[model samples]
Target: MRKIILSASVSLDGCFEGADGGLDWHLVDDELHTHFNDQLRGMSAFLMGRVNYELMARVWPDADADPSSSGPEAEFAGIWRETPKIVFSRTLDRAGPDATVMREVDPEAILELKRRPGGDMSIGGARLAARFRQHDLIDEYRVYVHPVILGRGRPLFEPSDDRKPLALAGTHTFGNGVVLLHYKSD
Candidate 1:
């Protein structure tokens, strides 16, 4: 069965976004962006929250059309457009092509998807990842930790009553001040 990987760019302080709901601090330069493209290109599908899906749909769909788009940016645009996406939303009535809007996260349904013949799936959005964590569905975690401290912002992992241990799978540092820490559930 394909694995469910929860991928996110977080801060050194363990925050995903700032108080104003911005990720300007993320140091996603060419090296990191290319790494993202390489990592996501092989995924069978993306599982994301409505907010994250909408945010990506707004920019990535036509990002390559812009003359100013960099090589990595254009590459990611195509990858994002071609990849199948499953959006979890209660408010969204529909989604774009190659996308499905789910009313909620169904663990059995996700497991069924994993059982099918395909590459691993990537899960986005902190809240949605938390839900997957609650169900113990995530098989791996690919965290890109940037060199910044958002002292105040939404944390990557919300406070939980239970503790889940992870074993380090691998680590890589990019030219930019970002590090990819791959971990697997223990």
Candidate 2:
């Protein structure tokens, strides 16, 4: 079965975004972006929340067309456009080409998706990830920890009463002080 990997970048303090919803703290240099592209190129699909999908649609679709985009940015634009996407949202009326909007999370449906013949899926969006985590749907977590402490921002994980154990699969340290911590659900 293909795995559902929850991939995200967080600050040293575990915040994914700043207080004002700014991502300027994200240290996605060419090296890091290239690494992201390398990982995403093998994914079968992107499982994301409506907000995340809409945010991506607004930028990635035209990123490559912009002459100012870097090589990694241009490459990611292609990857984002070509890969199939599954958006979870009830309010979203429609999605663009190669995208599907589901009204809610169906554990059996997600399991069927995992059983399909293809590469593993990369899941994003904190709320959606939280739901997947609650359902025990995620197989792995790829948390990229950057070397900065955000005084305040939206945290990556919410308060949970349950204990979830994750085994360390591996780790990769980037040149830009970002570390990718790979953990598998136990």
Candidate 3:
């Protein structure tokens, strides 16, 4: 079975976004970008929330068309734009070709997708990840823990009744003081 991997760049204080949903705090350095790009190589499908989809839709597909673009962001955006995405939202009427609105129900759709033939399905966005966590549907957690501490923001994990134990699979420190942590559900 394919794995439901939840991955994100989060602050030391466990905030995924700053007040006003500012994500300027999470910067992808060369080493970190390379590391994340390598991880993306194995992902066959991408899943995210509507908010994240809207945010990502602005830059990813258009990055290649921009003449002023340069460096890893362009490359990452190209790859991200090409990847198949499933965005979960009740209010979203339609999504572009790069992504489609999820038609099935939440956890069931995730499970069905996991069982299908694929490399690995990646779950992005904090809200979507929280939903997976709430349903105990996530198989792995690939987290990039940045050194900065934001005292307030949207949390990585929302209030839920379900809580499962995780075993650390690996840890690596990058040059930019970011720690890459891989954990598997126990």
Candidate 4:
């Protein structure tokens, strides 16, 4: 079965965004962006929340068309456009091209997608990931930790009474001081 991967970037302090609720600190240089492109190129689908989907839709759709876009940026734009997207939102009536807008996270539907033959699906957005985490639906977790630390901000995981253990699968350190910690559900 295809797996559901929860992938995200966080600061050294484990904050997804700064106090101002922005991810401008993410060290996404060409190498890192290329790495992201390589990793995301094969993803069969992307599970996202409305906020994340809108954020991406604003920039990525025309990023390649922009003359100032870098090589990796253009490449990633293609990858993003090609991959199927499933946006979970009650407020959105439509989404970008190659996207399906769903009102909620349905386990059976997710399982059906997993059962289909293809590459694994990635889930982004803290809220969407939280819902999937609560359902114990994520098969893998890939967290890219940057070098900077924002003393306080939104974390990838919210406090929960439940404890979900994960096994370390692998780790990779980029030249830009970004570390990718891969884990599997335990």
Candidate 5:
């Protein structure tokens, strides 16, 4: 079965965004950005919430405008264009090219996608990731923990009926104090 991985960059305080819903504070440095892009290279498709998808759809294409550009922004632009995206939203009617808007949280869809012969699927939004976790569908957890602490903001996991222990698979600390932690459901 294809794996479902949840990858996110979070603050040390366990928040995905700052108090103002601004991710500008959690900027990934050049080295970390390169590392993140390398990690994303293995994903066959992305499953994300409407909010995250909208934000990414708006920014990445603009970044891809110039092929001559170098760095994570450019790399992200190129790779994102090719990567398949499935946006889960009840309100969004349409998405840009390369994205499919999904209204239902169907387990059958996930099961079918997992059975297909392809690269791994990745869940990108905190809420979406939590739902997958609750459903016991996620195969792996990859958290890039940054040093800064955003006292309050969106959390990785909300109160839910499903809670499972996870075992650490590996961990690596970046020079900028960002720790990449990999885990599997225990």
Candidate 6:
């Protein structure tokens, strides 16, 4: 079965976003953007929350058309457009092509998707990832830790009473000050 990978970028202090809900602190330079494009290109699908999907849809869809967009940005635009996306939303009535809007996260249904023949799926959004973590559905985690410290903000992982063990699968430090920590559930 294909694995479910929860991929996200967090600060050194463990915050995913600042108190103002802005991700401007994320140091996604050309090298990191290209790395993201390369990594996400092989995914079977993206599972995300409505907020995450909408935020990406607003800019990525037309990014390639903009002349000012960098090579990596344009490449990522195409990759994002082609990839199948499943957005979890309570109020969303519909979604664009190659996308599905789910009212809730169903573990059985997600498991079925993983059983099918395909590459691994990537789950985005902290809240959605928390839900998947609650169900013990995530098989791997690709966390990119930035150099900054938010001090206070939304954390990458939600609070849980039970402790989960993860084995370090791999690690990479980019030219920028970001470090990728790949971990697999033990």
Q: Candidate 1 at 182: error in angstroms?
A: 0.6
Which model scores highest in lDDT?
Answer: 2
Clashes of 5: 0
lDDT by residue (86-108, candidate 4, tens digit) is 99999999987699999988888
Candidate 2 residue 96 C-alpha distance from true site, Å: 0.4
Among residues 3 or more apart in sequence or in different chains, the pairs in candidate 1 whose N, CA or C atoms overlap within 3 Å are none
Candidate 5 residue lDDT tens string, 1-186? 899988898888888877788888775778888987898887899899999998888778768577655678798887888899999999989887788998977888888999999999889988888767757889999998888888898777776776588999999988888999999977
lDDT of 2 at 62: 74
lDDT score for candidate 4 against the true structure: 0.93
lDDT: which is higher, 2 or 3?
2
Using lDDT as the yardstick, the better of models 4 and 6 is 6
Q: Which ten residues in a row have the lowest lDDT in candidate 6?
A: 155-164
lDDT of each: 0.93, 0.94, 0.83, 0.93, 0.85, 0.93
Model 3 ranges off by over 4 Å: 103-105
Q: Model 1, poorest ten-residue lDDT window?
A: 26-35
lDDT order of candidates, top first: 2, 6, 1, 4, 5, 3
RMSD of 1: 0.8
lDDT of model 2, residue 106? 96
RMSD of every prediction: 0.8, 0.8, 1.6, 0.9, 1.8, 0.8
Q: Which stretches of candidate 5 lie over 4 Å from their true place?
A: 66-70
lDDT of 2 by residue, 91-117 (tens): 988899889999899999999999999
lDDT of 3 by residue, 1-186 (tens): 999888888999988899779999986787787777778867888888898888888887878577776666677787787789888898888888877897534677778888899788888888678767877888999888999999899888877777688999999999889998999998
Q: List the residue pairs that clash in candidate 6.
A: none
